[model samples]
Target: MQEITDETELRELIGEPLPRAWEKERTSLHELDRAWLAASPFCLLATAGADGSCDVSPKGDPAGYTLVLDEGTIAIPERPGNRRVDSLRNILTNPHVGSIHLIPGRGDTLRINGRARLVRDAPFFDDMVVKGHRPVLAIVVEVEQVFHHCSKAFLRSQLWQPETWAPQAVPPRAVLAQTLERPDATLSDLEDYYGPSYADGLYRGQ
Candidate 1:
């Protein structure tokens, strides 16, 4: 098999994108883009380290959890989790980030590519409180390129189809955690940790 090493041959194989595809990207948010952010409860935050390694972390909250500071800037609150802070650490050395916002049951997504920075505190933190807990830090993104991504991927995967879902096709969370992440912990312990009460601490922590 021949390896395609250069953009010239790749372009020849895939052909150029349509004019509209090139023109659709906006450097800032539009009214519809604001609407999408308001409705999206989840997004994937992508980052690359100085060493070129990449990571994508999932961020989610109630719908409209994200705060759009302006047409060209946005802020995402940091939620308590495992505290790896992998994405935030990457942003320190490589400020570039890519985000894709998704609404439940929607195939289409809103994409943002931009430079990011970590903020320790902001007046807007008060606006982001949930369950009486305010975010201790936030990731602020300066909008570089924004666009509405097409739905072909979701449509092909049937991601939103309830009938197509088989959640139990894989081992449940507690089982996986016990087997893969905490071998010393009993399965019973892991189950209690990940059960219904797990969500109670979502917005309250040190």
Candidate 2:
């Protein structure tokens, strides 16, 4: 195999960004930004540590789960999940973060790059609460840049096309649990628990 170790080789392989892909405009969020936030049910959050180690986490809720506090800031609640807190820990150590909000079947996505801090204020938590379920913490992001991202990735993956979807039988969860020696696990039990717990927010629109 040939090794590519030079900047020239890297640039030649990747080429230049497309004119439209190269964002030349900056837009600040306003009251209208709430429309986009309200429409998106999912978003990907990217964070990094001081050492440059990075983590990307997927967050979702019913539409409008994220709130636009103002032109300069927005809020996202932390829901119940495994205790790893990888993304949160990264944010505490490194304030910079990037978020991409997406709506299934939608071509355009909202992208935001900014700094984030964890907050546990009662009012903030109360604002995020739904069906009597309140988040333990929320992330407040100070927006530095906001823009609309193209849909190339979704198109390439055919993410919203049902015909391109694969069957859900691969690498069965039981196999995964067994491979990891999870003595207290059962795939069926996990699925049963997941259905109700995940539907918690759906019923009350959390």
Candidate 3:
């Protein structure tokens, strides 16, 4: 097997894209693009660190949780999590980010490539509050290019089909602790620990 190292060789192998596919990308959000973002409850955010290492993280909430501030700007609230802040930290060093928005039962996805910055403005942060908990920060994206990605991937994977899903139950905390070799933990204690996090923000930092 030989490695393809240059764009010319790769492009020659794949050939030119269809005209409509090439022309579908827009500099700003269009009506349909806005609609897609409004209906999509989940998206994957991709970022690269200064060291060139990359990471992709999942962001999700209710439908339209990601706000379209205008045709050229989007605001995404950062929910509380493990607090590693890999994406947020990457944005600080490198403003470039790519996000793919997905809607259940929809074959086509929305892709956005742009520069991002973290924000903590008062009223903006207040607007993102859920269950009396506001995020410590939000990400503002300057729209550069947006497009409706094709459906072949979703069609092949049948991601939205319930019949294709795996049936697996979450193990009890005692079992989980034992698997991790934590001797003194109980299922009740684990439940008690995780229960409050769902209602109360896990990381409430500014």
Candidate 4:
């Protein structure tokens, strides 16, 4: 394996960025950018802690789940998940965050880099309510840079093609739970707890 750690060596191997790439970037959102976001149903949220550890979380909702407050700002309703809150915890110590928004069957992705803050404003939460359930918290991002990423990777992988997909093949949740160091829990107990709640659409409101 080659171990090239320095910037000069990496730059030589990667060469210059395409000149057109720079043209796609903007300091704020425009009409087309808004259109892309409005159609996107999912995104990857990236954050880093002050100690430099990083985390990437998947966020999804109905189309336009992430609200565009303005040209330079957007708000993402924090849906309920595992309750680990790693991303939110990271934002507290390091405000900088990045997001990659994706639309089904779209080759290009929209990328936004920004400063984020966790918010609990009631009016904002009300605006994000779905099915009569509002999120307890939301992450507001002050957009700094936005751009469209090219589609070579998505095209080559045929990501949106059903023929290229595979069924999920992971351990059962209960089995994985047994691996954790919980002396009072067992596999059957874990299944009894998670199975029904999951089947009941526990993930619906967030």
Question: What lDDT would each prediction earn against the true structure?
Answer: 0.95, 0.82, 0.86, 0.88
Ranking by TM-score: 1, 4, 3, 2
Judging by TM-score against the true structure, name the best candidate.
Answer: 1
> Model 3, which residues run further than 4 Å from truth?
169-206
Backbone clashes in candidate 4 total 0
TM per candidate comes to: 0.97, 0.83, 0.84, 0.87
| Pairs that collide, model 2 | none
| Among all candidates shown, the one with the greatest lDDT | 1
lDDT of 2 by residue, 146-182 (tens): 8887788888988899998876757655556555756
Listed per candidate, the RMSD to the true structure in angstroms reads: 1.2, 3.4, 3.3, 2.6
Off by over 4 Å in 1: none
Task: Report clash pairs, candidate 4.
Answer: none
Q: In terms of TM-score, how similar is model 4 to the real structure?
A: 0.87
lDDT, residue 161, candidate 2: 93
For candidate 4, the per-residue lDDT at 187 reads 75
Residue 97 miss distance in model 2 (angstroms)? 0.6
